[model samples]
Target: MTRRPAPRPHPANRPPARAIASAIALSLALGAPCAQAGESPATYLARIAAIDDAGPELDAVIVTAPSAQSAPHHPGAPLDGLSVLIKDNIETADMPTTAGSLALAGNATGRDAPLVANLRRAGAVILGKTNLSEWANFRGERSSSGWSGVGGQTKNPYATDRSPCGSSSGSGAAVAAGLAWAAIGTETDGSITCPASVNGIVGFKPTVGLVSRHFIVPISASQDTAGPMATSVTDAARLLTAMAGPDPADPATAEAGAHAIDFTRGLATASLKGLRIGVLRRQSGTMPGVTALLDRALADMARAGAVIVDVDYTRDPAMGRDEGIVLHYEFREGINAYLASLPGHPAVRSLEDLIAFNKAHAKDEMRFYGQEDFLEAQGSTYTAAYRAARANSYRLAGPEGIDALLARDHLDVLVAPTAGPAWTIDPVNGDNFPGIGAGSLAAIAGYPHLTVPMGAIEGLPIGLSFMAGKWQDERVLKIGAAYERARTATLAVPRFKPWSPAPD
Candidate 1:
């Protein structure tokens, strides 16, 4: 666990005269953009570098490649001239995939992940790599969400003092802050939806096997998949279309070619009409403010002509416990295999090596929290215990969880509050995340989950989630697009204020 930085004044509360002057100067340096004008790659990269690295010090972007300035852009490509940021865990031929760890500083493989290759073919410029929770937040129980040994902490742009959520923290923050038009984020659980919700952006976690996972740093093959994070549902849909396809390297994606469709094709303001949406009231937690917002969202859906059905998510309470057991086993095996496959000799070649490295460099790597999870994972074996855990988790979370709820309610999709507003970042005690997140069911089931900005609580954004049975990625996106269009006027842009107490 890296040490937390000292607290700083909120930009709105009080700013030193010199700091204000410096911000003004930087803003002037970044000239205004023409409406709907296409940006040159060089100009796009420079703007990101200036805003993310310099002006607000968002710490979202880890590195930008020079080749981005010369990256090909075909006029007819769907994503032509669009700038996209890759989460650091995803391999890039040009940049090191550090996964926010000092141990992987030499981990550049010079081979793009299949997903990256698809994005390039669509003419999207890879702006840079964004920081993430070190080891994708799998290192410790008390670990901070967005703090990484290699890239430091990534602060939420909405409220600088709040947590951005993990492990796709930078991807969410970057897109919300306008550092890039969109970004790629990988999730095993709450990684994509949590951050995207708190950051007031759109995140689409596609159905497992819908997108290739080749060349991505692994967490669990059972749950991991990379998806798009964008400021709008339509943009996310478009990016998903470009990145999704069948890949020979990943057999899980064997059915992807048949299911892949232009996700943006069916998006319409009336898409939600005539749809049966199950309202998951039990999952939104005890926060009154969040519940109020959720109620309003439900009313909005009713007005949109969606038939709302109340549904309860009743599942084995041990599902989470079993999921953890499966992850520990998979993390040890997947990480070791991924490390062994790196192009060249790397310092941390296995899970055991990584644990030893952390012990050897405790001052830098474990300054605030120990790698308890890593140590626990090392003791796991892929035997009967692992297989049992996986089977139990899937059965509980899938057939007995989301599937049961949807089937009983006769629902096309289930809706719930993605999460509460961002929590204050605390280094000493780690993340103080509030509210219940509707990520676990979709994550464990390897199904599609989409989160869209709902509204805000004291300037911090809340999100509404849409989830469906596996392979319903298009349905989720279309519905989310409809909701987004209906609520666009109420959505508040981030002001980057310092954290303050929520109103009672």
Candidate 2:
């Protein structure tokens, strides 16, 4: 809820001239809720499916995620019946990983991505794939998140008019709307966390290499990693623990596996007691009503005996430019590798092919946005800028940022408002929200970051982020579980409606 301004003097007590101005100020201070209550998947899917027809057009999102078809039914597996929603870009044998574009619309992979394999090995059911921005929104500058030619647009369950906030839009919205128990989302920059934050769900972006990016579409191999999006931090940790490991297909896996740990053990409420947390004041000030919520959160932390150390932001030119350079170089390299792995796909086989297809199919692909980012990537080259930015990102978000603050302040973790309230979804102009994400440090550092539903803005929910340095997933999970227990908010689900009438 938005906060009210401090009370003003009584009209008779105050100077006559100031009465009108004070009233106006107070009225402006009260803002509307930015979020709406989300529905549970089991309840909402039937209704949603009725409003949204299920067919070939929207199948990619579901086909690529964990479904019964994708799972190995043998006994002894850990996640046997647990459903998973794979992002469209991740390869799945049963469905095409189109990256939401028509360029590879008819293409299908023969093998599952390493992460899906891991999910299956753990006994989870492969539910289906979730929709996402085409090419993870790297294809265009004005591209809308969650809009794709293959799956159309994924409407946010909270408000049909608001943007879902992502490249992982479908994954975030589906999980939050109760389409599944948990869904897998991949990120290059803010794809996973931003969507999770906006949707009021738990989002975890593991350290780079902690999860293999082998068959997943990439923007920058330097930063991209697959993580979990779920209803709670405990669920995210459970998924993360199952997915972490090495893959011979991805060299980055070596580093990740070495740092991987069973992140779900030692559940504790006392973990919050005496823990030191760095709060980045810069990340939380943009939205209305957020400060009050954060204040309450901080007070709760204090009562729990956690120490808060506020981090001061010093402008660093290098840090600002890292994500751009790294993504451009990686997009060019990653897309090419993914295409070659497809045995005999037609229509799109390379970035150039994707560009041509967009040009050829302007009415559908270019209906909302153009391929300017793809154009930019096409013209861009891997230069010293990329290497320099990579190093700076690692330094700033890692040792010089989170690690330095932790050691200096004797901290255990970090905290922030994940993102502000959900914004209205606009197809023509796209999303417009008042807040910024607070997960950049952990994301860029390749550490683990988790966001849980803190409270509602309007009727919609908002999230609070908890992050820790590499391999401290369990510590954060424990803290998150405690918060969930205290909050006791039930998750929402999508209500599916029937498509056609049937005779009895």
Candidate 3:
């Protein structure tokens, strides 16, 4: 037995360098698991915690509570051993759902949102809560994207000083930085996709009703939905599959069970072949770097057997004004309802209560921007004016917006740049997001939108968006997966570098 300690494994017996390298390359190419075998949830949390607030100082996480950490393994469950970060707005029994504001500091409901329960049932470890734009970026006009009173500013991992883009800023940054395998981010407008794009990750804003929004802090009931942000389309699709299902608490999800599909099923590189993809070229002009990347993406898709059709899709100018009206009406209605539904009395009981709390904590909450949007929303009423605005906004963004173009061109999906490169995080002037975004149409229409990493500009990542009609989530994910496969080689990984001024 003493002699049976066995000859200690030696470097001489190890596989050749070339052989080991080839094995790794093959594994990555085949999309095999890259994490070490039997990696513990604690191991992952430790790794992410090191970089989250200390190394790059991304400020992407609001809280990493002890209770959120998972124990050991659950091999039989769907997401066995996977770790997931929940956006701070999504209710978690163990952690506070701050929505990146000081007003809701101790608003721990001691209950999981329906979606979070689903994730837990599938064996996912709720790792922590990620920072978000305060009140999901609906608190003010010209507000900084990733700044929050509770979590400070979530920096873009690609460049420390660049905006991570909200309101899912931390969700996106955390996934992009490998903090967790995936994250849950809710989008009312561009909250999910914009941050996913700039952070160079796959963000899927599912059809509005496909995922239950029962416990999420609301921006708009008409458009808010929690989505999956992951490093790969396949992972995003998998997360979507687990999260999509009907919930009794949310009437909107009544049809979700019927519409939900195994999104990762039958995914192949040939998925793009013969598919008619209409290119949304109008929004590609503002950034030449982004335009160039988009042009290359179009060509690549064409070469991959996609029917490239140039479609002119112009958003109605009045849509924005109408959307503002609807959001304001809903924000006040939804936030009040959410506060009332909480089990314990929270610090801020209503939208007006929140406004006062911010006023009281001006030094922290109002350092950069005031709650103008909240003020405007508080004044809005759910009257005929609100109903009319909602109907008009939906009509313009749907039937007259994304729908018309797809129908005209007989296209399967519409493609556009998700957003421009990450902008500098300017607390004084706020977000200077210069490029066009395709999220508005799909967002207001309550349709599915998926953003996959396209490439980068000056080290800042950009994303290509694929969208389709309502409940066409599977189609969007499939097409996105195909494009991601083709462009995998060119996709850049994040380098936590600090931002620098442009050369003279």
Best-to-worst order by lDDT is 1, 3, 2
Q: In terms of TM-score, how similar is model 2 to the real structure?
A: 0.83
Query: How many clashes does each candidate structure show, in the order listed?
Result: 1, 51, 0
- What would the per-residue lDDT of candidate 1 be over residues 335-442, giving only the tens digit for each residue? 999999998888988998999998898999999898988988999975798889889999888887788888887899998899888988887799987857678999
Backbone clashes in candidate 3 total 0
Candidate with maximal lDDT: 1
Q: Which 10-residue span in candidate 2 carries the lowest summed lDDT?
A: 27-36
lDDT of each: 0.83, 0.68, 0.82
Local accuracy of candidate 3 as per-residue lDDT tens digits, 1-504: 011012333556544556444433332332221222223456555555445544455677777757545345668987887878899999988888888887888787989998998888888888888888988999887899988888888888778889999999999987777677788999999999999999888899999999999889998989999999887888888889889999999988989989988888876643688999998888666678888899899988888889999988666788999999999999999999988778887898888899899899999889888999989999998689999999999999989888888999899999999998888889999999875767899999999999988887877788899999988888898898888767733655566668654333
lDDT of 2 by residue, 1-504 (tens): 100011323445433334333322321121111121222323233322322232111221443332343345647665556767789888877766777777777677777898888887887766667888778878776667788887777766555556677889988876655556678999877788888876667788877888888888778877788899876666677788889888888898886666667676765443566677777778777566676667667777766667778876553556657766677777887887778667774677778887888999999989888888778777767677677878887898888887887787777777778877667656787666565555767767877777777665554556778878877766777776665554533333221211212122
List runs of model 1 lying over 4 Å from the truth.
1-39, 501-504
What ranges in model 2 sit over 4 Å off? 1-76, 268-270, 314-317, 433-435, 486-504
